[model samples]
Target: MIKFNYPDGSHCYRALHTAHAVFRNDDGKLIARAEKADRTGMYEFEITGFELLSTGIVYD
Candidate 1:
């Protein structure tokens, strides 16, 4: 797994079951990661409740 810091200066992690996050929404409410196979495949994310939000990537 990899680590990343959000726009709000908060920290979060990439989903082990999914791919590493490569893109995120402006409001930090959504995320989009690269696929393990092609690194350009589709990514899915669902934001709910008080889950951590991400706007951009800080590190890999």
Candidate 2:
């Protein structure tokens, strides 16, 4: 899973996928995407409509 922090400090998530993961809305339009930066649990996120507040790994 992918953990997401919203602009208002709220949190949400999406299914974890490859580096080129895509976050789309119900209309099949793109919302955001992610790329793994390194092994340090950091990732680069590109989002639309809402601000990309923050991101981190979810250790199971």
Candidate 3:
């Protein structure tokens, strides 16, 4: 498994799984990180839950 640091500043990601996050940069480039939740299994959250509330899809 490849490991990476989360991007700088605030960020949003597509949750592929409990341990994976897919992030798209401003340039439209994409990357996947290895971890999403901490040891307690809490999520870091994405898109402020607004889009998730309006639609089932997540946005970046």
Best by TM-score: 2
* Model 1 segments more than 4 A misplaced: 20-60
Task: Provide C-alpha RMSD values for all models, in order.
Answer: 9.9, 10.2, 11.8
Off by over 4 Å in 2: 18-60
TM-score of candidate 2 versus the correct structure, residues matched by position: 0.31
**TM-scores, one per candidate:** 0.30, 0.31, 0.25
Clashing pairs in 1: none
TM-score of 3: 0.25
C-alpha lDDT score of every prediction, in listed order: 0.50, 0.49, 0.39
Ranked by lDDT, the better of candidates 1 and 2 is 1
lDDT of 2: 0.49
| Error in Å for residue 11 of model 2 | 1.2
Best by lDDT: 1
**Deviation (Å) of 53 in candidate 3:** 28
